[model samples]
Every structure is written in C-alpha cells, then in structure tokens.
Target: MKSVHLTEGRPLAVILRFTLPLFLGNMFMQLYNLVDTVIVGRFLGENALAAVGSTGTIIFLVQGLATGLTTGFTVLTAQHFGAMDPKGTRRSASNALMLSFGVILILTFFSTLFMHRILLIMNTPAEIYDDAYRYIIVICAGLFSIVLYTLGSSLLTAVGNSRLPLVFLMVGAVCNIALDLLFIPGFGMGTEGAAYATVISQVIAALVAAVYIGRKMPDLRPYRDFWRLDRGMAIRQIRVGVPMALQFGITASGTMVLQTAVNTFGPTAVAAFTAASKMSTLLTQGFAALGQSMAAYGGQNYGAARPDRIRSGVKAAMQIDVAYAALISILILLLLHPLMRLFFPAGTDTGKLMEFARPYIYFSMSCYIPLGMIFIFRNIMQGCGYGFLPMMGGVVELVARVIPAAVSMRLGSYLLAAACDASAWLTAGLFTAFAYHFYVIGRIEQRIRRGRARMDASPPAPKKE
Candidate 1:
C-alpha cells in the first residue's frame, strides 16, 4: 500500500522513483522471454529454437495489439487519477477490463483456429512449418493468460504502482524458469513444453495482479455501479485504443514480412534473426521502462493541467535515455561475440550468425538517439490526450518496415531486412518530432500567452482591492 507520491514538487525525483520499479519489472518480463529461448536452445535443440522463433511475428502482432489497447486504458486511468476523479477512474477501469477480456477471447479463438493458415500466409518454409504450427497453436490457445497479465500490469502502471507488478513479474519469471526445466528436460516436452511454461506463468502473474488491485485500491476499484456498459466511454476507449492496436499489428505485420524474408534464407538465418531480436529487446528494456514511466508522469500531469511539469519530465527522461543508450550500445558491440556464443553455442555456425547480426546491431545504434526521442515524443503526446499521434507513428513504422523489406527481397539481399528496421525507427522518430512541435510546444506556448494576458488584465482590479 505504498503511495505513488506523483503530485510532489520534484518531477524528476518522482519519475525516477516510479520508474525504478518499472524498470526492474520490465527486465524480469524480458528475462522470462529470454529464459524461454535459452531453455529451448540449450535443452530442446536448434529446431526447437526455430520452432519458437518462427512464431515471433505472430506473437508480436497479437501481444502488441493487446499491449496497445492496455496502454489506452492506462492513459485514461492516469488522466482520471490526475484530475482527482476516482469515480471516473473506476468506471473507465471496469469498462476497460470487460472490453479487454472480450477482445482477448475473440483474438484467442481466431489465432488458435487459424494458427497454421496464418503461418502459411506468412510463407513459412516447408521444413519448419509443422513445428512452427505446433508451437503457435499452443501459444495462441493460452492467449487469455497473456492478455490478462498485460491488462493487470497496465492497470497497475496506470495508477502509479509499478512495484507490485514487478514483484508479480519476478514470481512469474521464477515459475517460468522452473517449469521450463521440468517440462522440457524432465518430461521431454520440447517446444510445446516451453510454450506451456510461458502461459502458466502468465496466468499466475495475472491472478496476483488482479488480487492486489482488488484488495489495495478500493476507491479505484470497479464498483457495481460501473459494471453496466457505458457506450460513450467504451467508444472513447476503443477509439483511442483500436488505432494504437492496429498500429502495432500493422508494424508487426511488417516484421512478419521481414520474417518471411529471413525464412527464405533458411533456418540458420531465422535462428540468427531470432537471437539478435531477443538480445536487442533485452538491452532495450531499460529505456522502454523509462519511456513507460514518462508516459504515466506526463499523462497524470497533463490531466492535472500542468504543462510545465510535463516539459520538465521529458527533459529528465531524455538525459537518462542518452546515458542508457550509450551504455547499452557499447555493451552490445563489445560483447557481441560472447553473447552470440551464449545463445548459439560454438559448434553451430556461430561465426556466420554473428556476421549476419553485426551490421544490424551497428545500424541499430545509429538510430538509438532518434529512437529515444520517439519514446519521449510519443509518451508526451499520450500524456496530453493526443493519443492519435502515437498511433500515427506506429503506422509510419509499419510502412517504413514493409516497403524496404519487400524491395530488398526483390533484389535478393537479406541485409535489407535489417535496413528496414532502421528505416522504421527513422520514420517513427520524424513523426514523433513533428508531434512534439505541434501538440506539445504549440499548446504550451499558447497557454503561456493566455496566462500573461490574464495577468495583465487583472492588475487594475487588484490595485482597487
């Protein structure tokens, strides 16, 4: 029951305090994914790793959509909390919870039934298609756990309670790791075992999060009054959220296109791509967590009508981001060989895998600063009730990733897939920068001007008083 203390005067201190727990929590979440990969790689074998990797695009699409919608909920909750409207928060939260469950159930059903068909549409190769289908089917069937975990975590983050989510994530990660060992090695379950472990852990985390929310924050909890559907609120949430979800899905679809390109190169290349993406995500988690913190910070202040505080928070976030980006980039470059070895091992064309990945990592570094800016910009917009900009940025990324990948494949070079990723960052960064200028800077300046005019006009009245 520790308080968030977000309304304190020191914005940086407040944000950092809030962000640290989130950072740790996100790291554990990333670790859960990494551990799954590691167990599958070391114990289950390369084909197993490929099996899991093959579903990367689909997972990103489904999970990213859920995450995006959950983000919309978070934005609404933070705004209501900032405005000191507990009843509104409760109503919005209830609507969001109901909507999320319904959407998740629908997605779970479709994804499960068409898992194989979707993979074929992605042009999954002949040799690996069966394993990929097996892996995806199991994962999709357990989509509720994934959705619930995200929904719970998003709600907690929205209310400025990051620590609880982190604790739950740690418990889940531990459970996942233990289950991975038992199911994969002890029971000889293979890739299906790994997928099962993941879903079970998700269920545990979701349950823990739900219990905490119900017990601790009674004021913010959904009451019976809030349970009946409010058409306007539901529409507003979906309007804000669906675009964001589509944006992620669109962007992930581009990745699926890229995955198709990588698959064309064979399983070795697919494995390499999978390893690189996982490693990069591991590194990126720190900054991503910071970005989420900024979103909450910005969203709350924006709702409270404190534009200055949002500006200050963005500056502080940028400073932290730069330092983190540099450190992570250096670590990635310096330890590239060792890191690859850790995942791919020595005997299995590790050298070739590294060769394929080195350039992509280097290119990724070129855009880290811009990438950081994108997070700041997008979060700022979301905080200010300008959710559309973030969604637009997602669409820009989707287009950027897809076009280059398609053109590159036409010319027969896998390197283009890496190039497409970098291009997406550039496109997203530019759009986000524009949003900053128009929405943030423009609004703040207008506010300042109006404030000055009001002050000038009020002087005569004060003198008379």
Candidate 2:
C-alpha cells in the first residue's frame, strides 16, 4: 500500500526522482529492440537486418495500441490512489485486466491472420518479404505476452511504482539478449529466433510482475469476485482508453505510410532507415520518460483536486525536458557516425547506407525540442482527462507526416522524406499545446475558481464558542 504520492513536495525534485527510474525503464524497453537490431544486423547480415527493421512500424502499430490502452486504463488507478480511495483503485485495476484480455485476443488474431497482407500493403520488398513475414508472424502470434506485460507495468506505474517495473524490465532485457545469442547463433533459428526471444522475455517479465503484485501490493490485486462486470466502470475506462489507443494507432499509421515509402526505395534504403531509427529511439528515452512522469504526476494531482500542482508540475517538467533535449541533441550529433557503425558489419560498404541515413538522423536530432513537447503536452493533457484533443493532435501528425512522405516519393527525394518526422512533431506539438491552453488550462482554472468560491461561500463557525 506504500505508493509514491506525487500530490506533494517540490515539483522539480519529485518529478526528477520519478523520471529517472522511468527513463531507465524506457531505455530498457527500447533495449529489447536495440539488442535485436544489433544481433540481427551484425550476425545475420543486411537482408535479415532489413527484414526485421521493416517490421518496426507494423510492430508499433500493434504494440502502440496495447501501450495506449494500458496507459489510459491506469490513469484512473492513479487518480483513485491519489484520492486515497483503495476500493476504487482495486476495481479499476481489475477492470483494466479484464479489458486487456479481450484486446489481446483481438489484436493477436487480426495481426496474425493478416500478417502477409499487412506486409504486402506496406509494399515490402520481395527479396526480404519472406523473412519479414516469418519474423512478424511470431511477434503477432505472441502478442498476448506483450500486452500482459504492458498492462502489469502500467498498473504498477499508475500507483507510482516505476522502479519495480524497471527491475523486471532489466531481467527481461538480459534474458532476451541471452536468448537472442543462443537462438540466432547457437541454434541457427534465423530472424524468427529473435522474435521468439523477445516474446519469451516479455512473458517472463509479465509473470514476475504479477507475482510481485500478489505478494507485496495487495491493494493492486484484482477483486475476489473478479469476473463480475461493472458496466458503468467499464464504460468510463473505455471512454478514456479508446481515444488514447486511437491516438497511438493514428500516429503509427503515419509511420507505416512513411515506411512504405521507404520500402519503395528498396532494401538498402530500408536498412539505413532502420539503423538510424534505432539510434533515434534509443536517444529519445529521456523525453519519453518525462512524458510518462507528467502523466502519473498529472493524474495523481488531478485526483487530489490540485490543479495548481498540475500546472507547476508541467512547468518543471518542461524545463527538464528542454534542458535534456538540448544536451542529448549535441551528444547524438557528435556520436552519430560511431553509433551508425554499430548496425552494420565492419567490412561492409556503408557509404551508400550513411548517404541515406545521415539526413534522417541529423534532421530528427535537430528537432528534439518539438518531439519532447509532443510527449509532454499530449500525455499531461490525457492525464487530465482530455483524451480527444491529443487524439486530434495525432490526426494532425498523421496528415503532416503522410503528406511529406508522399510528396517525397513523388519527387524521388529521400531527404524530404526524412523531414517528415520533424514536420509531424512540430505540428503535433503546436496543436497539443494550443489545445492544452484553450481547453485544458481553462478547465483547470474553472475548477480552481469553483473551489475558491465554495470556500468563500462556506458557513463560518462561531468563534471559539
């Protein structure tokens, strides 16, 4: 029942402490992909690497839904916990688990059944198509493991226990690396081996998290009559969860469109895009963590009916985000060459690869501030129960991204395509920020004014009668 209540203390210090664990956890989550890319690229060669890389956006398309759903579900748990209502927290947690089961089945079924067609739709290169099919199918089939883990970790995070998830993720990541080495080299399982390793590791993490919750965090455990459904409760969760999931799905669709454009350029370009993107993902974990911190922080404060704290938390978080973005931007620019080298073999001709990838890495790193803003405002707004606005931001991003990528294709300019992400981030960040100001900020102010008015109107007690 010991939870890190973010409803009190200095905003900066508390956010920093919360964000550090979340940051490391985010990096470890990204580590799963980094290890796969490194092992596949180095040991299996370019075609196998490109094959795995090509599945990135599609994987995001599926996993993103799981992430968004879990995140949205837990926002309620965070709120209940913040309001010091254990019964509400437990009920919400149970409903989230039940909801996750239905989603897992549906996602796994569709992703597996239409695996080949999804790849075909993405315009996957014929040479690498078979390998891509094999790799993605395993991930799709084991989609339940990923969803289960996401739900567990998100619940823990909801109650302000980001550290435990990080520990569990570390265990899973290490196990994943060992399995990747064994299956890929020791047993010659090829690209699919990497997929198996990832799924198995996720199962391990999910199981560990469940056991820990059972033993330590009894308050977070499902109700005794877990099967009983509360229609109103489920409806409320769906109201929040569905829009958040759609936001992720919409954003991912844009990436999928961009990936298809990259695919049209052939496997070599695909590999370059993959390598650069892995690095970009790795470097941005800090920003992602800040966004997560804001969600938990905002939710808890909102539940505690402290709009003032939420405002201050956002200010502190933005400061941290801007500073970190500036530092990481400089570091990535300096280390771009060496980092890019890790994705390819020593003797391979990397000139052509860098030719395509350099622009992407450079452009993305240059726009880190906008990217960071997108994470911060969108998440904090969702935490404040304004899900639809963020989803609208995602639609803006989709339009911005798709238009540039398609135009780049028409002009046969990969460089212009590389600018797509920057444009999307800039547009989405602006949209979300404006939404927060126009909608969320006003709402918070109204709540604050009502609380003040209620206090002013209260009957005064007789003085020391």
Give candidate 2's TM-score.
Answer: 0.96
In candidate 2, what residue range of length 10 has the lowest lDDT sum? 222-231
lDDT of all predictions: 0.80, 0.88
lDDT of 2 at 106: 86
Q: Residue 430 in model 2: shift from native, Å?
A: 0.9
Model 2, 152: alpha-carbon shift in Å?
A: 1.0
TM-score of each: 0.93, 0.96
Candidate 2 lDDT by residue in tens digits, 1-465: 367899989999999999999899889989887989999999899999999999999999999998888778888888888889999899989999888998898888888888888899999999999899999999989888888888888888888888998998998999999999999988999999999999999999999989999889966987588656678888888888889999999999999999988988889999999998888889899988999888888888888888888888888988997899888888878887787788888887888899988899888877888888888998888887779998999999999999999998898888888888988988898888888877897797788678879989999988995
Query: Candidate 1: worst 10 consecutive residues by lDDT?
Result: 1-10
lDDT string, candidate 1, 1-465, tens digits: 553636557876787788898889888988889888888887766667776898988999988888878777667878788778888878888888888888788888888887778888776777777777777788888888878888877777777788888899998999999999999889998888888999999999889888888888764589877888778888888876777677678778888888877777777777777888888888877767887887778767766767778777878887887888899889888877777766653477787887677767877877777777777787777756666778888888888888888886788887887777788888898888888876765775576568668878875654553
